[model samples]
Target: MAEQQTWPHHELGRKLNNWGRWGDDDQIGTLNFVTPATRVEAAGLVRTGKSFDLGMPFDKDGPFKAGGFRTNPQHIMTLLPSDTAHTKDGLISADDMIITGLQAATQWDGLAHAGYGGRFYNNVPAAAVNNFLGATRNSFHHAVERLISRGVLLDIARLKGVDRLEDSYEITEADLLAAEERQGVRVRSGDIVLLRTGSYQWFLEGDREHFLGNAPGPCLDTCEWLYEREVAALAIDNHSGEVWPSPIEGVTIPFHQVVIRDMGLTLGEMFNLEELAADCEADGVWEFLFCAPGLKVTGSAGSPITPIALK
Candidate 1:
């Protein structure tokens, strides 16, 4: 008979030997703007009288879609008198909105989600795992209380000009610099860089077959460059930091593994970049972006986000 493995539960020990390789000689510890947001910003880089939901529209056919083993659920009920309180000038509107579904949109990811032996980013010890329930993807990158500084937008899709980024298309370092030079932008250290590949545009148009098929992503050379520049974090309008079906076979997203796992930095996936790109074009510079994600505790990867840019 085979011996059954017992659940360790809370009895975690030293499982972070692999995490030591992620840090560098000068990688900054604390951040400012990239941290989690708890309240609405009274003053920010951009303002709007109406809230343009960054979240993907939640319908069977909405562009922002997530494939998982489970979905969200919710319920709503209305409270009103039988005759509208018998008044023609009721204070409240006649119709109210009630919505319930999977919590498909949230921002959270802890060390427990990745890393070997359950070690987290920065090599946080296994014993420190708390407030995280379920899986590691729910709590992988938590940069709350950190500050994000100036941002740069690298619009690769516009540089390509096919309306959207196709799957398996590799984004090279040349692509990055060409876009930057074309936009007259310079990438600085400790900056939040958003790479717009236009993948989200197709996803929003109900083109699932193509949307999910494959998309553009960076290669190892570009990743090494960004890491060398000491970027705070890098995000994109695609599923991951690397292209699917990989341009070079026998080498899976070596850049992703090297950056996120070996470099100790973070990554943001599934971002909505249309508006941000447009804002960059109008500004004549593809920089000056500002974004802060919601702090959804006890959750894994956040839902879709619609980051904005300012002039």
Candidate 2:
């Protein structure tokens, strides 16, 4: 029989690393597991042609403040006249410009986005990861390369028989397992896992403060749980992938440091998962073909993405 796989769990300051697992100059982190064969296998999950888009509509009226750390997308028409002639009276065209942050809406957090103890993924300096332009050492280009895979949805709200979990609720390992059993699906290696707290449902209903200020999500406890499973990436409909006012007292989002820093895990946030969950509910299966990758914007900390799930 094949030897059982064991994941080494590390304490804070001491990381469970995949640094040299791929290579010394490896920009892509855990995504190295997503081989070409994985894509072939994942494509088989698409039995029906139905597709679900997991991106929130982005504009000035979206979920972010105007001039905050993260802002809504700003679109401007370059041509003052709608039918500006480019060459002659017969030729006309329209042009526009977008000044927007990559992480403003549904997006993927690049490898250089976060770290702990001043070290980024693979024990590199955080400062070196991003420069005056954008990310350099670990950019969105590397993050987007390994996105096609099997998608798994774990609806925590539906599992708990509620519209949404409590604002401060922390999803535990048991909750994930319960959702898997309830949905008759198991998370596999190279799978992009998405969790739904029904928080997006409230945002869709015009509850912005409750959705942004506080939300239900995972905590530091699941860092090893997901790392051991060898998942390609994780996504959620909430603002932060972890619970707001995190359970770790006197600290803010230690879970982020654990997963993104120590485990080299990429994360996606603000995904619109309401329709996807409803479809999964109707069909008793939570697995599908996930084809969502960050844009190939070189040296970007993150990239806005509209992920699609085909079933």
Candidate 3:
């Protein structure tokens, strides 16, 4: 892994910081935009009564490698039917257990997932996230009931007439605006935008390495656009939510530092958007009710989510 560069982050952080925008004790950050009225309006989008699952399967074949910083889910059968066959009532059952990283599959990154300048969201000290307690501040549980809202799918790949964007393609603000215009939809405040680069097709085709490396996604320049639009959160169909290989020469994932650390924005990754994209294209409807609540795992940095889009 390369060292993270810290040349322009301080200036950018000051420009887009949301430290006290919500409150001094804020934990959920921009998710505060998903108000009750927005959720009620989003529920009105379900005219066809169709739904799409946007989560990838959790198993050993996921994107992460074994013995790495993160590994795929490991399912173990805790109890077998044969073990209970000696019961006099002839009762038998099977039980299983799953051990995996919270972000091994489709997931939402909590505010504590990234930090810089020795602070988390809302100016929380980075030392709050100790090895013993996971994350004492800005944990995933803070956003559990706040993720329900209208979702807009900006299919950049389809906008460019390609099945998938080229590897390391930097999706710009212009591309996002063009997609919204071409799709005949407009992104509004409090909308959770789902950006589709269509790079997850590589993982679906059994190319985990390709799925995790050099993927196409938003560039650092789009962070200001997101802040200005007041987007509650962003989910993308890729491993990282930004273009790989540090588009800024020496900075690794500068978008994450700006968005997650400074802007206090939540991010979702590894979502399977193919089925949802097909449905939207067929019906010519790009907006839907997106209800994906993270698990109430206190102090956890992130949580796996099986996101659902109802149309």
Candidate 4:
């Protein structure tokens, strides 16, 4: 995306990490800043009561392309036969089920989603997460309650005057500040920052290859920015939260190491923010109420979510 800037930039990210910043046995990491008062403060931003949906549709034609390590969701239905279950006695009933990966569509990555050097977030051992009980440590269960707060959108692609950023275009700290200035907004503590790279619009235009694979996004430097800003969570309209083919050689998804693992930040990916961005620009408001809660699937590493932004 940019120069060969390695992740875990010692000057920035390494110092901003929340490793034990909360406690030695912390489950919800940086989310500790999202108190009840924070939600109350966020609710005040809804002047017009307009809402934006941040979730992509869930189905086979999902974000992940063919032959990836993770595939899209699969739907299955089962028919039941019983004296009290059928419509033959003037009763109509049906049941359906979905068997799919948790993070297949618009989803939230849990504390157990990614790690490095045999350690997950808050020094939770990676082995504790991959066990037979299905991610016993730092699972998505801990995130079931802390997904509501203030939401801010920084439309990087719109700032660059492009429908889509070049694949692997690394977003910089200056770009973030410039976006804030242009939008006339200031990111507050416990804000769920939505970094709109316009990948959602590309996915809408049938550019699946670029949206699913070679999408542009932030680099590790942006993780440092997230940390310094005290953001409660991060959502991006791209595949991975960071740029692909990692900025560092021989280190795949290094941004995951710093953002999710080291900093213990909650990450939301594949959110549909095209309408939200347009509405924000038209209404001259970039801050709103962010709300998205996990399914509370015990031991799961991630879960599908439908985030809503109220303006």
Candidate 5:
């Protein structure tokens, strides 16, 4: 096997100049300004099993929390109330009631989403940013069109002899390797590593108490290894990539800062990974992966996504 390549400026510049735009972060979120354009290839969406629902429900007329940056909306009306009424009246609602706010569920944080000190994605300094467009000082130049890439699922559940891994268990580098070794799989660079901790199962069951707690997630060492492996992005079945109330001393989910700032890696949290994992196990081929985040417009984050994989 050959050594994996890193996407740092020097190497990335050479690759871009020679091979055109590749890599996950290259997808700029701004495609099809007025009209809808094809964001993903139809062939890439190969559904093998049941579809996963990655959206979180919002409370209707729920009180807004103090100091909350997002203003949650309530869906009180729908286009069609019932098929009988619609057929009799010849009236069909075109829109469904929905509440839009800061999407905390299955979403991708743009490079501009967060940063420590003064660096954004690609390690670009704050001083280099152009704030005239309302973009932050440490913003990442993304438009969403460049996010198309191959995805890989790491099935940690089957390795544990269960339908899903236990919730609140911190996934360690050892755990990751053990799973890989057991499955005879090797993680490649620039692959979107989707980890199935089985937290999503609990989530779908409406177990809010356990879902919000410290769910199974990857440790900092795993983040470091993924960075070293040049993983373009990472998605997990848990809420955040790092387990909540982090065990790392004197730090608050330092892995997030380290991976985002230092490695310029993108994080995908709150994903529905059960079906993806099971499909891979059934096919005996766990490598072909694909993802296309919802086109972000007039919002900080997007709604849930139904990213799929091929055999």
Candidate 6:
């Protein structure tokens, strides 16, 4: 049997639990791995001065549609050119506003975003998060400045020689290792690993249904690999960071509960990684200086991010 199938989902969560690993008052989770020295080393990775934006555009046409609990970004023009025309001295300017779900586009799922057994990361009670306050314990605000670090791209789709992996394909720890070997790069401590399944191509092609449906992503057992490697954060080219319609019995999104809640690892979802993957393929360099800081939303469980990779 595969290693991930050996243990129940909840048991895996317990085994990989990182509660109190940092400290009692720790809210940033594994982001603590990105030390000052780590950021300095990551800065040395920029050679060509090329950059890639790995975030999907936040607009009305994003993958998230209406009628769902979370909808796509709705941009409203608060001040249009016509409205600004009334201004004097040609100082007219247009302004706009957006109403969006924090996780509607490319976003970082904070430590409080998922939990099991009425507890969050660091053994914080789920009650700490309330409707009015929203994730008081492991809020996104704590992670705002900690996400910048070295990013390693593990292009699973490219390793498998496919534009995109099949639906519900569960990428395992072995797959990650294989991709690392194939790409000639290694995942190191404090690295913000980006796993590319090429799933975002569907959204770029105007097929939002397929993009949001069952898509390829890391499986439950991969959490162990990430924990062992001390990855600070993880990003994927899918809505959820894990494979959909979860392979585990009686559990949906088991990876989320384990990685986010137990391991205290932040997850970035709906990232656009095609351009970065292509560049990595051409240059044979999979590591880059990654900077994707979350908004200082005081009590938010998640925050939209515009991830950038400098090479």
* Tens digits of per-residue lDDT for model 6, 75-114: 9989877877766776677898999889989999999889
Query: Which of 4 and 6 is ahead in TM-score?
Result: 6
Candidate 4 or 1, higher lDDT: 4
Candidate 4 vs. true structure, TM-score:
0.92
TM-score between model 5 and native: 0.68
Write down the TM-score for model 6: 0.95
Better of 2 and 4 by lDDT: 4
Candidate scoring better on lDDT of 1 and 6: 6
Model 3 stretches with alpha carbons more than 4 Å out: 1-6
Q: What's the distance in Å from true for residue 282, model 3?
A: 1.4
Better of 1 and 4 by TM-score: 4
RMSD of each: 7.9, 5.9, 2.7, 3.8, 8.7, 3.5
Residue 77 deviation, candidate 6, in Å? 1.7
Better of 5 and 6 by TM-score: 6
Better model by TM-score: candidate 2 vs candidate 3:
3
| Candidate scoring better on TM-score of 1 and 5 | 5
Tell me the lDDT of model 6 at 295: 83
How many clashing pairs in candidate 2? 0
Instruction: Give lDDT tens digits, candidate 4, residues 192-265.
Output: 89999887877788777767776688886677678878888899998787787687776787777778888888
Clashes of each: 25, 0, 0, 0, 12, 0
Over all chains combined, what TM-score does candidate 2 have? 0.92
Backbone clash pairs for candidate 3 read: none
> Between 3 and 6, whose TM-score is larger?
3
